[model samples]
Target: MSGNKIVAIIIVGLVHLLVGYALVTGLAYSATKKIIERVTTVDIDEPEPEKTEEPPPPPPDEAPPPPIVAPPPPININVAPPPVTVVDRPPPPAPVIPIARPAPPAPPAPPPAVSKARGVEPKGQSRWAARIQENYPARAVRSGTEGTVGVSVTVGPDGKVAACRVSSSSGSDVLDEAACDGMQRYARFDPALDDAGNPTSASWSTRIVYKLN
Candidate 1:
Protein backbone atom coordinates (compact mmCIF):
# COMPACT_ATOMS: atom_id res chain seq x y z
CA MET A 1 0.00 0.00 0.00
CA SER A 2 2.79 2.66 0.73
CA GLY A 3 4.43 2.03 -2.51
CA ASN A 4 1.19 2.62 -4.27
CA LYS A 5 0.84 5.94 -2.58
CA ILE A 6 4.30 7.17 -3.44
CA VAL A 7 3.84 6.42 -7.04
CA ALA A 8 0.59 8.22 -7.15
CA ILE A 9 2.26 11.35 -5.60
CA ILE A 10 5.01 11.39 -8.22
CA ILE A 11 2.49 11.21 -10.99
CA VAL A 12 0.79 14.41 -9.67
CA GLY A 13 4.05 16.30 -9.47
CA LEU A 14 4.86 15.57 -13.08
CA VAL A 15 1.43 16.86 -14.29
CA HIS A 16 2.05 20.26 -12.50
CA LEU A 17 5.43 20.80 -14.08
CA LEU A 18 4.07 20.11 -17.47
CA VAL A 19 1.28 22.76 -17.06
CA GLY A 20 3.69 25.59 -15.85
CA TYR A 21 6.15 25.02 -18.68
CA ALA A 22 3.34 25.20 -21.33
CA LEU A 23 2.04 28.56 -19.94
CA VAL A 24 5.47 30.32 -19.90
CA THR A 25 6.36 29.17 -23.38
CA GLY A 26 2.99 30.51 -24.85
CA LEU A 27 3.55 34.12 -23.31
CA ALA A 28 7.08 34.48 -24.71
CA TYR A 29 5.98 33.46 -28.21
CA SER A 30 3.16 36.21 -28.31
CA ALA A 31 5.61 39.02 -27.13
CA THR A 32 8.23 38.15 -29.78
CA LYS A 33 5.52 38.23 -32.63
CA LYS A 34 4.34 41.83 -31.69
CA ILE A 35 7.95 43.17 -31.69
CA ILE A 36 8.66 41.74 -35.15
CA GLU A 37 5.47 43.28 -36.71
CA ARG A 38 6.30 46.84 -35.26
CA VAL A 39 9.81 46.81 -36.69
CA THR A 40 8.77 45.60 -40.20
CA THR A 41 6.28 48.50 -41.32
CA VAL A 42 7.73 52.07 -42.55
CA ASP A 43 6.97 55.22 -40.36
CA ILE A 44 4.23 57.67 -41.70
CA ASP A 45 5.47 61.42 -42.19
CA GLU A 46 3.38 64.49 -40.88
CA PRO A 47 2.84 67.58 -43.22
CA GLU A 48 5.01 70.72 -42.49
CA PRO A 49 3.31 73.69 -40.76
CA GLU A 50 1.73 76.31 -43.24
CA LYS A 51 3.90 79.47 -43.96
CA THR A 52 2.52 83.14 -43.25
CA GLU A 53 3.20 86.31 -45.53
CA GLU A 54 3.27 90.12 -44.59
CA PRO A 55 1.48 93.07 -46.49
CA PRO A 56 3.23 95.89 -48.65
CA PRO A 57 4.00 99.44 -47.27
CA PRO A 58 1.76 102.56 -48.00
CA PRO A 59 2.39 105.22 -50.87
CA PRO A 60 4.18 108.66 -50.29
CA ASP A 61 2.38 112.12 -49.88
CA GLU A 62 2.00 114.89 -52.68
CA ALA A 63 3.09 118.68 -52.64
CA PRO A 64 0.82 121.80 -52.20
CA PRO A 65 -0.36 124.38 -55.03
CA PRO A 66 1.01 127.96 -55.70
CA PRO A 67 -0.72 131.46 -55.22
CA ILE A 68 -2.03 134.01 -57.91
CA VAL A 69 -1.26 137.80 -58.42
CA ALA A 70 -2.76 140.70 -60.58
CA PRO A 71 -1.03 143.33 -62.84
CA PRO A 72 -0.96 147.27 -62.40
CA PRO A 73 -2.49 150.12 -64.52
CA PRO A 74 -0.70 152.59 -66.93
CA ILE A 75 0.10 156.38 -66.34
CA ASN A 76 -0.56 159.58 -68.48
CA ILE A 77 1.73 162.68 -69.02
CA ASN A 78 1.15 166.28 -70.48
CA VAL A 79 3.77 168.98 -71.36
CA ALA A 80 3.34 172.80 -72.05
CA PRO A 81 5.01 174.85 -74.86
CA PRO A 82 7.33 177.92 -74.39
CA PRO A 83 6.16 181.59 -74.90
CA VAL A 84 7.04 183.83 -77.92
CA THR A 85 9.48 186.85 -77.82
CA VAL A 86 8.90 190.43 -79.21
CA VAL A 87 11.63 192.62 -80.93
CA ASP A 88 12.10 196.50 -81.14
CA ARG A 89 13.12 198.60 -84.23
CA PRO A 90 13.88 202.30 -85.03
CA PRO A 91 11.35 204.82 -86.62
CA PRO A 92 11.27 205.83 -90.37
CA PRO A 93 12.82 209.13 -91.71
CA ALA A 94 10.78 212.31 -92.64
CA PRO A 95 9.77 213.31 -96.23
CA VAL A 96 12.07 215.38 -98.55
CA ILE A 97 11.82 219.25 -99.03
CA PRO A 98 8.63 220.36 -100.89
CA ILE A 99 8.76 221.11 -104.66
CA ALA A 100 6.09 223.64 -105.88
CA ARG A 101 4.19 223.15 -109.14
CA PRO A 102 1.52 225.14 -111.10
CA ALA A 103 -2.09 223.95 -111.70
CA PRO A 104 -3.52 222.75 -115.08
CA PRO A 105 -5.20 225.31 -117.51
CA ALA A 106 -9.02 225.77 -117.69
CA PRO A 107 -11.08 224.19 -120.50
CA PRO A 108 -12.89 226.24 -123.22
CA ALA A 109 -16.48 227.38 -122.47
CA PRO A 110 -19.52 227.00 -124.79
CA PRO A 111 -20.77 230.14 -126.63
CA PRO A 112 -23.63 232.10 -125.00
CA ALA A 113 -27.12 231.15 -126.32
CA VAL A 114 -28.44 233.56 -128.99
CA SER A 115 -31.63 235.33 -128.02
CA LYS A 116 -34.25 232.79 -129.30
CA ALA A 117 -37.23 230.55 -128.42
CA ARG A 118 -36.30 227.67 -126.06
CA GLY A 119 -36.54 223.88 -126.94
CA VAL A 120 -39.98 222.19 -126.63
CA GLU A 121 -41.28 218.62 -126.37
CA PRO A 122 -44.53 217.01 -127.60
CA LYS A 123 -47.82 217.93 -125.79
CA GLY A 124 -49.31 214.62 -124.49
CA GLN A 125 -48.32 212.12 -121.73
CA SER A 126 -47.52 208.92 -123.74
CA ARG A 127 -48.99 205.42 -123.00
CA TRP A 128 -45.99 203.57 -124.50
CA ALA A 129 -46.18 200.46 -122.16
CA ALA A 130 -49.19 199.19 -124.17
CA ARG A 131 -46.97 198.79 -127.21
CA ILE A 132 -44.48 196.60 -125.26
CA GLN A 133 -47.21 194.24 -123.81
CA GLU A 134 -48.88 193.74 -127.23
CA ASN A 135 -45.61 192.57 -128.81
CA TYR A 136 -44.01 190.77 -125.84
CA PRO A 137 -41.89 187.78 -127.06
CA ALA A 138 -43.74 184.41 -126.91
CA ARG A 139 -40.72 182.82 -125.14
CA ALA A 140 -40.68 185.57 -122.48
CA VAL A 141 -44.45 185.29 -121.92
CA ARG A 142 -44.34 181.49 -121.68
CA SER A 143 -41.31 181.39 -119.35
CA GLY A 144 -42.90 183.97 -116.98
CA THR A 145 -39.53 185.75 -116.63
CA GLU A 146 -39.93 189.45 -115.71
CA GLY A 147 -37.39 192.28 -115.53
CA THR A 148 -36.75 195.99 -116.24
CA VAL A 149 -34.42 197.46 -118.91
CA GLY A 150 -33.13 201.03 -119.50
CA VAL A 151 -32.58 202.15 -123.10
CA SER A 152 -31.05 205.24 -124.80
CA VAL A 153 -33.03 206.26 -127.90
CA THR A 154 -32.54 208.64 -130.84
CA VAL A 155 -35.67 210.42 -132.20
CA GLY A 156 -35.35 211.41 -135.89
CA PRO A 157 -36.59 214.68 -137.41
CA ASP A 158 -39.63 212.73 -138.77
CA GLY A 159 -40.86 212.08 -135.15
CA LYS A 160 -39.96 208.37 -135.11
CA VAL A 161 -37.58 206.22 -133.03
CA ALA A 162 -34.47 205.98 -135.20
CA ALA A 163 -32.25 203.85 -132.91
CA CYS A 164 -32.45 202.15 -129.53
CA ARG A 165 -29.71 200.86 -127.26
CA VAL A 166 -29.77 198.94 -123.95
CA SER A 167 -27.72 200.92 -121.41
CA SER A 168 -28.38 198.50 -118.48
CA SER A 169 -28.96 194.75 -118.30
CA SER A 170 -32.34 193.38 -117.14
CA GLY A 171 -30.43 190.43 -115.62
CA SER A 172 -30.90 188.57 -118.93
CA ASP A 173 -29.39 189.13 -122.38
CA VAL A 174 -32.62 187.92 -124.03
CA LEU A 175 -34.82 190.49 -122.12
CA ASP A 176 -32.38 193.35 -122.76
CA GLU A 177 -32.13 192.65 -126.49
CA ALA A 178 -35.91 192.32 -126.78
CA ALA A 179 -36.41 195.74 -125.12
CA CYS A 180 -34.12 197.58 -127.56
CA ASP A 181 -35.53 195.72 -130.57
CA GLY A 182 -39.15 196.42 -129.52
CA MET A 183 -38.43 200.12 -129.02
CA GLN A 184 -36.69 200.51 -132.36
CA ARG A 185 -39.39 198.57 -134.25
CA TYR A 186 -42.60 199.97 -132.74
CA ALA A 187 -41.93 203.21 -130.85
CA ARG A 188 -42.68 206.68 -132.31
CA PHE A 189 -42.19 210.21 -131.09
CA ASP A 190 -43.80 213.66 -131.78
CA PRO A 191 -40.23 214.92 -131.96
CA ALA A 192 -38.72 218.13 -130.48
CA LEU A 193 -38.32 221.69 -131.73
CA ASP A 194 -35.19 223.82 -131.68
CA ASP A 195 -34.93 227.62 -131.04
CA ALA A 196 -36.10 228.35 -134.61
CA GLY A 197 -39.22 226.02 -134.25
CA ASN A 198 -37.77 223.45 -136.72
CA PRO A 199 -37.79 219.64 -136.34
CA THR A 200 -34.54 218.31 -134.84
CA SER A 201 -32.98 214.99 -133.72
CA ALA A 202 -32.88 214.37 -129.94
CA SER A 203 -31.68 211.75 -127.50
CA TRP A 204 -34.07 210.26 -124.90
CA SER A 205 -33.69 207.67 -122.16
CA THR A 206 -36.60 205.41 -121.11
CA ARG A 207 -37.23 202.34 -118.93
CA ILE A 208 -39.60 199.37 -119.52
CA VAL A 209 -40.86 197.24 -116.66
CA TYR A 210 -41.99 193.65 -117.43
CA LYS A 211 -44.33 192.20 -114.75
CA LEU A 212 -46.63 189.15 -114.57
CA ASN A 213 -49.59 190.87 -112.85
Candidate 2:
Protein backbone atom coordinates (compact mmCIF):
# COMPACT_ATOMS: atom_id res chain seq x y z
CA MET A 1 0.00 0.00 0.00
CA SER A 2 2.82 2.42 0.92
CA GLY A 3 5.92 3.16 -1.19
CA ASN A 4 8.44 1.81 1.42
CA LYS A 5 6.49 -1.43 1.89
CA ILE A 6 6.28 -1.96 -1.87
CA VAL A 7 10.03 -1.43 -2.22
CA ALA A 8 10.85 -3.95 0.60
CA ILE A 9 8.54 -6.52 -0.92
CA ILE A 10 10.23 -6.16 -4.30
CA ILE A 11 13.66 -6.61 -2.75
CA VAL A 12 12.56 -9.89 -1.02
CA GLY A 13 11.26 -11.24 -4.28
CA LEU A 14 14.56 -10.51 -6.07
CA VAL A 15 16.50 -12.34 -3.39
CA HIS A 16 14.39 -15.46 -3.90
CA LEU A 17 14.88 -15.31 -7.64
CA LEU A 18 18.62 -15.18 -7.27
CA VAL A 19 18.53 -18.25 -4.97
CA GLY A 20 16.48 -20.22 -7.49
CA TYR A 21 18.84 -19.29 -10.31
CA ALA A 22 21.75 -20.46 -8.28
CA LEU A 23 20.07 -23.82 -7.85
CA VAL A 24 19.39 -24.16 -11.53
CA THR A 25 22.96 -23.29 -12.48
CA GLY A 26 24.25 -26.40 -10.71
CA LEU A 27 25.83 -24.61 -7.75
CA ALA A 28 26.60 -26.79 -4.59
CA TYR A 29 23.10 -27.66 -3.61
CA SER A 30 23.58 -28.57 0.00
CA ALA A 31 26.08 -25.75 0.63
CA THR A 32 23.82 -23.22 -1.05
CA LYS A 33 20.90 -24.65 0.80
CA LYS A 34 22.74 -24.41 4.08
CA ILE A 35 23.76 -20.86 3.26
CA ILE A 36 20.17 -19.96 2.41
CA GLU A 37 18.84 -21.51 5.54
CA ARG A 38 21.42 -19.78 7.71
CA VAL A 39 20.68 -16.47 6.01
CA THR A 40 16.91 -16.96 6.39
CA THR A 41 17.04 -18.36 9.90
CA VAL A 42 19.21 -15.64 11.37
CA ASP A 43 16.88 -13.57 13.72
CA ILE A 44 17.77 -9.84 13.70
CA ASP A 45 15.98 -7.67 16.28
CA GLU A 46 14.18 -4.49 14.97
CA PRO A 47 14.83 -1.28 16.91
CA GLU A 48 11.81 -0.06 18.99
CA PRO A 49 9.89 3.03 17.73
CA GLU A 50 10.47 6.31 19.70
CA LYS A 51 7.51 7.27 22.05
CA THR A 52 6.20 10.93 21.71
CA GLU A 53 3.72 12.56 24.22
CA GLU A 54 0.22 13.45 22.78
CA PRO A 55 -1.19 16.99 23.22
CA PRO A 56 -4.16 17.54 25.59
CA PRO A 57 -7.69 17.80 24.08
CA PRO A 58 -9.22 21.34 23.57
CA PRO A 59 -11.98 22.61 25.98
CA PRO A 60 -15.69 22.79 25.00
CA ASP A 61 -16.89 26.10 23.45
CA GLU A 62 -19.58 28.32 25.14
CA ALA A 63 -20.82 31.57 23.54
CA PRO A 64 -21.67 34.58 25.87
CA PRO A 65 -25.22 36.05 26.09
CA PRO A 66 -26.12 39.35 24.41
CA PRO A 67 -25.90 42.68 26.47
CA ILE A 68 -29.09 44.19 27.99
CA VAL A 69 -29.98 47.81 27.13
CA ALA A 70 -32.31 49.85 29.45
CA PRO A 71 -35.10 51.94 27.94
CA PRO A 72 -34.71 55.77 27.89
CA PRO A 73 -36.12 57.79 30.82
CA PRO A 74 -39.69 59.08 30.48
CA ILE A 75 -40.13 62.71 29.34
CA ASN A 76 -41.23 65.36 31.91
CA ILE A 77 -44.80 66.67 31.37
CA ASN A 78 -46.10 70.06 32.79
CA VAL A 79 -49.41 69.60 34.66
CA ALA A 80 -51.53 72.29 36.45
CA PRO A 81 -52.34 72.01 40.20
CA PRO A 82 -55.88 71.25 41.49
CA PRO A 83 -58.26 74.28 41.87
CA VAL A 84 -59.23 75.51 45.41
CA THR A 85 -62.85 75.06 46.57
CA VAL A 86 -64.55 78.39 47.49
CA VAL A 87 -67.27 77.10 49.93
CA ASP A 88 -69.08 80.48 50.54
CA ARG A 89 -70.91 80.04 53.90
CA PRO A 90 -74.45 81.44 54.14
CA PRO A 91 -74.44 85.17 55.11
CA PRO A 92 -74.99 85.28 58.91
CA PRO A 93 -78.75 84.49 58.91
CA ALA A 94 -79.80 87.97 57.69
CA PRO A 95 -79.09 89.83 61.01
CA VAL A 96 -82.28 88.80 62.93
CA ILE A 97 -84.65 90.94 60.71
CA PRO A 98 -86.65 92.54 63.53
CA ILE A 99 -89.90 93.78 61.97
CA ALA A 100 -90.70 97.31 63.12
CA ARG A 101 -94.27 97.55 64.54
CA PRO A 102 -96.32 100.70 63.93
CA ALA A 103 -96.79 102.97 66.97
CA PRO A 104 -100.14 102.88 68.80
CA PRO A 105 -102.82 105.28 67.42
CA ALA A 106 -103.11 108.53 69.38
CA PRO A 107 -106.27 109.25 71.37
CA PRO A 108 -108.93 110.79 69.15
CA ALA A 109 -110.03 113.52 71.61
CA PRO A 110 -107.18 114.98 73.71
CA PRO A 111 -107.61 117.06 76.89
CA PRO A 112 -107.31 120.84 76.66
CA ALA A 113 -103.66 121.94 76.91
CA VAL A 114 -102.76 124.18 79.86
CA SER A 115 -101.11 127.55 79.07
CA LYS A 116 -97.40 127.73 80.07
CA ALA A 117 -96.93 131.53 79.72
CA ARG A 118 -96.45 133.43 83.00
CA GLY A 119 -98.00 136.89 82.80
CA VAL A 120 -95.65 138.29 85.50
CA GLU A 121 -92.97 137.07 87.84
CA PRO A 122 -93.21 137.77 91.63
CA LYS A 123 -91.88 141.25 92.72
CA GLY A 124 -90.05 141.81 96.01
CA GLN A 125 -91.08 144.66 98.40
CA SER A 126 -88.88 147.75 98.78
CA ARG A 127 -87.70 146.71 102.29
CA TRP A 128 -86.54 143.36 100.92
CA ALA A 129 -83.27 144.96 99.71
CA ALA A 130 -82.29 146.19 103.22
CA ARG A 131 -83.06 142.86 104.93
CA ILE A 132 -80.13 141.00 103.24
CA GLN A 133 -77.19 142.93 104.91
CA GLU A 134 -78.99 142.90 108.25
CA ASN A 135 -79.11 139.09 108.16
CA TYR A 136 -75.32 138.48 107.77
CA PRO A 137 -74.26 135.65 110.15
CA ALA A 138 -71.90 136.55 113.05
CA ARG A 139 -69.59 133.53 112.33
CA ALA A 140 -69.36 134.33 108.62
CA VAL A 141 -68.54 138.01 109.33
CA ARG A 142 -65.84 137.09 111.88
CA SER A 143 -64.16 134.62 109.52
CA GLY A 144 -64.09 137.32 106.79
CA THR A 145 -65.76 134.87 104.35
CA GLU A 146 -67.29 136.73 101.41
CA GLY A 147 -68.89 135.26 98.25
CA THR A 148 -72.02 135.49 96.10
CA VAL A 149 -74.76 132.95 96.90
CA GLY A 150 -77.61 132.14 94.43
CA VAL A 151 -80.93 130.99 95.79
CA SER A 152 -84.30 129.90 94.39
CA VAL A 153 -87.36 131.12 96.28
CA THR A 154 -90.87 129.67 95.88
CA VAL A 155 -93.67 132.20 96.52
CA GLY A 156 -97.26 131.06 97.13
CA PRO A 157 -100.40 132.72 95.71
CA ASP A 158 -100.76 134.52 99.02
CA GLY A 159 -97.69 136.64 98.17
CA LYS A 160 -95.50 135.00 100.89
CA VAL A 161 -92.23 133.18 100.55
CA ALA A 162 -93.00 129.47 101.08
CA ALA A 163 -89.64 127.70 100.38
CA CYS A 164 -86.04 128.73 99.76
CA ARG A 165 -83.01 126.71 98.63
CA VAL A 166 -79.42 127.52 97.68
CA SER A 167 -79.10 127.11 93.92
CA SER A 168 -75.36 127.90 93.64
CA SER A 169 -72.47 127.67 96.10
CA SER A 170 -70.72 130.70 97.70
CA GLY A 171 -67.61 128.55 98.64
CA SER A 172 -68.67 128.94 102.31
CA ASP A 173 -71.50 126.79 103.70
CA VAL A 174 -72.04 129.32 106.51
CA LEU A 175 -72.90 132.16 104.08
CA ASP A 176 -75.10 129.95 101.85
CA GLU A 177 -77.27 128.67 104.69
CA ALA A 178 -77.68 132.21 106.16
CA ALA A 179 -78.89 133.51 102.81
CA CYS A 180 -81.82 131.05 102.64
CA ASP A 181 -82.75 131.63 106.29
CA GLY A 182 -82.99 135.44 105.83
CA MET A 183 -85.16 135.12 102.69
CA GLN A 184 -87.70 132.85 104.39
CA ARG A 185 -87.88 135.12 107.50
CA TYR A 186 -88.21 138.57 105.92
CA ALA A 187 -89.02 138.25 102.19
CA ARG A 188 -92.46 138.73 100.59
CA PHE A 189 -93.54 138.76 96.96
CA ASP A 190 -96.40 139.82 94.71
CA PRO A 191 -97.56 136.40 93.45
CA ALA A 192 -97.04 135.55 89.79
CA LEU A 193 -99.89 135.53 87.21
CA ASP A 194 -100.56 132.89 84.53
CA ASP A 195 -101.69 133.43 80.94
CA ALA A 196 -105.32 133.78 82.17
CA GLY A 197 -104.18 136.63 84.56
CA ASN A 198 -104.75 134.49 87.69
CA PRO A 199 -102.44 134.59 90.75
CA THR A 200 -100.21 131.38 90.87
CA SER A 201 -97.30 129.82 92.80
CA ALA A 202 -93.92 130.47 91.19
CA SER A 203 -90.13 130.14 91.80
CA TRP A 204 -87.58 132.97 91.46
CA SER A 205 -83.77 132.91 91.44
CA THR A 206 -81.76 135.61 93.30
CA ARG A 207 -78.18 136.07 94.47
CA ILE A 208 -76.74 137.69 97.67
CA VAL A 209 -73.24 139.14 97.72
CA TYR A 210 -71.12 139.64 100.89
CA LYS A 211 -68.01 141.83 101.37
CA LEU A 212 -65.71 142.46 104.35
CA ASN A 213 -66.43 146.18 104.26
- Candidate that would win on lDDT: 2
Predicted candidate 1 versus true structure: per-residue lDDT over 89-197, tens digit per residue? 6567787888878787887798886644433243332555567656676787799888899988888888777888888778877788888887776677777778776
Best by TM-score: 2
Q: Where is model 2 poorest over a 10-residue stretch in terms of lDDT?
A: 117-126
lDDT score for residue 181 of model 2: 85
Q: Write the per-residue lDDT of candidate 2 for residues 1-213, one digit (tens) a residue.
A: 999999999999999999999887766777789898988897789999999999998987888888899999998687788998786785566567789999999879977768755632545555774687677889988888899999998888887778989999899999998888888887877788776667888888888887777
Residue 2 of model 1: what lDDT?
Answer: 98
- TM-scores for candidates 1 onward, in order: 0.41, 0.42
Clashing pairs in 1: none
Task: TM-score for candidate 1, please give it.
Answer: 0.41
**Which stretches of candidate 2 lie above 4 Å from their native place?**
1-126
